[model samples]
Target: MTRTHVSLQQNFAGIVLTQGDPGYDDAREIFNAMIDRRPAVIAQCRTVEDVKAALAYGQREGLDIAVRSGGHSVAGASVIDGGLVVDLRLMNEVSVDTDARTATVAGGATWADVDRACQPHGLATVGGRVSSTGVAGLTLGGGSGWFERKFGLASDALISVDLVTADGREVTASAEENPDLFWALHGGGGNFGVATRFVFALQPLPVTAFALLLWLPETARTLLRTYRDMVDRGLPLDLGGGMAYLTGPPLPFVPDELQGRRLIGMIATYAGSEAEMRSAIAPLLALNPVASMIAELPYTEIQSALDDPPGFRNYWSAQHLAALSDEAIDVFIAQGEAMLVPSPSQHLILPWGGAVADHAENWPQPHRSAAWVVHPFGLWEDPADDDYVISWARNAVAGLQPYSTGAVYLNFIGNEGEDRIVSGFGRDNYDRLTRVKAEYDPANVFRLNHNIKPWTP
Candidate 1:
């Protein structure tokens, strides 16, 4: 029942929660524990009309507006202190359009919602590796997952978006309709408007494949060689996976001898028949894993394998590379040796070539030229060891600057600042994005994100 864009502040019809409201603080917070903001008013939008009223109200009242879906932006772009936050957390609705082979996802829905909805039908759309991640932020920012190697990404699979413009009018952007907006949203991050619902193409998800993991004992060289070959000839399109260098944890399952030692682990996914899956991963399995945990499980279970519990302690950082060169392997080993800790934190080099790399020029993504995504993530619950956690993250991220391609995945970025956002789009991609943002949001109403500056007139 939502109509096109029109200023409707005078007829605003929604809950405008002020600072004194009991739920105000909860409304402005995001998944990242580090971010803390106090929006002057948080609008709990139950419908598109509620969103319109909130936007129109913000514009007319001379206040900035921030739209929050999952509230998971690493840049913490979803909310602002003393501004207006249009919260769509209550709008999580999943509808499967089986005939169209598409799923209509509400803005507030997370990957968990989508995955749970589609898994029963043996169909899945591209989603983030983390199930709790919101569909809106991840999708708009270019969703990547274990399946990305075979299925492309969430952004490329976008079919349409129902959005509310600056003045509160609703519109739909799609490839055949608003092509420019479509391209921008594909990887440009949020700029056009508040997308309330997203339609995505879905594909069949396999019941299981061979998931493999072998620990590397200071074996960076051998691991890198195997990685290069794996990426060159991926396990299987059905078997989207990666092998990683790791520092062993003291989990009861890990032999006490290898615990707390530098080891390599292969986090693999074989999306095919068991026999084929086992054969596809045979090369890496042949590498002699200290301990192996490979099995034929359901797709939904594997997708949720690394699901971190809520209220988890998380610290993540990443770099982009055009190629994982031999010289780079030296750097990887040297840095891993220095930065590796006795804890569970793992350093990862996720292969980035294949369909992810075979893009035409000017695809609107700055990291397009990059060949792989390297993420070194840490997790711990001890508040007393905050220094140790921060130190580990900094050392690992700092040493890899030389081999990195400029820019990064917005999802993997930390509190590095506005500068990192500019870097995420690459110098050139940022320029074009700024222009696109200016075309639609001239006043910068959507400034509370990995912001694209309003274009200079």
Candidate 2:
């Protein structure tokens, strides 16, 4: 072992994994199977002191540091080759306050951890559609989720965040403390510091409904139009979900003939009873779905139903639309038809107007003003299909450029370029976020993410 590695092992109060270590390979695995990186050290931290020591060690040795929570970064920013990774997975602890209607989640905790803890109390906060995503990563990147229309973005529900800064200082950001840092944390990504914990005000979730309705590709255009009309005619904020083009899973609810085939589908979540959901979505139901399933399940159960398993080659991109014009709908439908069949790709268009637009000015994600988000999520297994799948997602975004609002949701995309980063958070917000980066991480110690270079004025 190198002198620095030996020193870290001796001084660091965490499980320091080096090359050839027993759990090193497994510890390096992230949600994206495509990312193969070997960090010089993987510090599996179990306490805040361990995080501080790891940060100081990396800085002292000039090793690039990657802060990992659930390790769900599509770009694989959570792990770095020949560097140090502060793996916070061991710090996954959550405490829910039933009386205060709030949840305090450790940085490494996943949405599943948060939801399972809150479910028993019949309370929930906005979280990513898939439960495996990290609470800190998703929330800081302007979390978009199943109940965003009703609860606002996950960052919107954030009551406070505790973080360890680049210079080894522990701090907290909230409305009353470090307010500027708090504002930048919303949708700014992991550009400032290593978030250790987050506090969120939860909402009552007494009755929840989950539904998935499927139809053949031949019905794509028809169902899309009906779905668009349903959203336009004032769908309630309590109803959330989207339409997508995906390979039909072999679920019992899916027709035997349709399993493994490409299909157009709608997945819906309602913050109400199954009967109310049936009434609310009656218009789409009247169109005669080929295969479907609806259940009055617990909120936690439905939240995890769509969790994408790891070990798949993944590429994704998103475009925010000013409005879903019929012309844009045609472009979206045509792209869905051109997608790689029998793959796990999804050409999605989700409504974003209710609580999202309502609270747009509360944070820096200007794209929330958009009426819809077109996300083309590409997931396949073969490395040979990587180029094809990436091109498909890129072309999906290009096709709708004419209707795009010129802003994006960073979490839905991989590392496209700096221009796309600027486009994600408008140029102005990007400028402001840099100033915050300058304060907490002037040397840009945390540069693995959608990095914001420290601003000097």
**TM-score for each predicted model, relative to the true structure:** 0.88, 0.99
Error of 2 at 42 (Å): 0.5
In the predicted model 1, the residue pairs found to clash are 5-169, 215-264, 216-263, 216-264, 238-271, 239-271
Q: Global lDDT for candidate 1? A: 0.73
Which candidate number maximizes lDDT? 2
Segments in model 1 whose C-alpha atoms lie over 4 Å from true places: 1-29, 210-212, 233-235, 245-263, 338-344, 360-362, 382-388, 415-419
Best by TM-score: 2
What ranges in model 2 sit over 4 Å off? 1-3
lDDT of 2 by residue, 75-99 (tens): 9999999999999988889999999
**lDDT against true structure, model 2:** 0.91
Which pairs of residues collide in model 2? none
